[model samples]
Target: MGIIKLTNIRVYAYHGCLVEEGKIGSDYRVDVSVTANLQPSATSDHLKDTVDYVLVNQIVKEEMAIRSKLLEQVCKRIIKRIFNEIDIAEEASVEVSKINPPIGGNVEMVTIAMTLHRSDYSDPTQL
Candidate 1:
């Protein structure tokens, strides 16, 4: 088993409870960590045999484009997408952060994070 981590993925997206926040958008940083068996790729040295970081990043980007009201929901979507799309990932964790969020005070950012195991996910297609 091994862990693959992607950090500080900067994306400008409109995701917040405030209506104006969605219109103007804000900077977001996402971090993801995936755990899976790496023995196959470790020996084969083939991208096909392992989780692709590029694909992971693309998934995050795609999800970020969709507007959401809460960071927790964003984190949930990211984790679920990774587990569903990336067959090699046995477990996944994600952190979603909004930079300089408008909270009526000086705040650098607000972040929400979540982790899930593959078994915990129920495929939407199946439902």
Candidate 2:
């Protein structure tokens, strides 16, 4: 198995419980990683045979654009989209970080991370 990682995807998005936060928005960083079989692509030298980072990046950007109250929600959407859009992906993990959150203390960032296996979605109760 091989992994494809897209890290430090920066975006400014409105995602928070506070009204001020929704209006003012916050800076966010997203990291996505996927595991898949790369041997086919390695031998064939073809993009179709492996998990594509471009699609992964696009999924992260699109999901981040949508406003959600929690980082976990955002991460779930990103993972779901990656699995739906990328057939070769066996597993996907997403980390969403809110930079300089409004937690009333000196904090660099708050991040929520989640991982999903392709089979996890088969039963909605697991979610």
Candidate 3:
């Protein structure tokens, strides 16, 4: 097993509970970690044998494009997509940060994180 990490993906998006937040949007940073079997890729050195980081980034970008009321929901969506679409992924962790949150006080950001294993995820097709 091996861990693949993609960190500090910056995006400007509109995701918040407040009305103004959605109109103005904010900067966000996303981090993703995936655990999978890497022996095949490690030896064969083929992109097809392992999780593709570029595809992961595209997924993140696509998810971020959708507006949501909460960071927790966004984080979950990313985790679920990675686990379901990436066949080699055994586990996935996602972190989302809203930079310079509008909390009335001096705050740099607010973040939400979630982790899930492939076995723990419900089959989407059954739903």
Error of 1 at 75 (Å): 1.2
Ranking under TM-score, best-scoring first? 3, 2, 1
Candidate 1 lDDT at 106 equals: 96
lDDT of residue 13 for candidate 1: 99
Can you write out model 1's per-residue Cα lDDT over 3-86, one digit (the tens) per residue?
999999999999988999989999999999999999999999999999999999999999999999988888878877887788
Residue pairs with clashing backbones, model 3? none
Error of 2 at 78 (Å): 0.4
Candidate 1 versus the native: TM-score? Answer: 0.93
Estimated TM-score per prediction? 0.93, 0.94, 0.95
Best by lDDT: 3
lDDT of 2 at 95: 92
Ranking by lDDT: 3, 1, 2
Candidates' C-alpha lDDT:
0.89, 0.89, 0.91
Off-target runs (Cα >4 Å) in candidate 3 are 122-127
State each model's C-alpha RMSD to the native: 1.7, 1.7, 1.5
Best by TM-score: 3
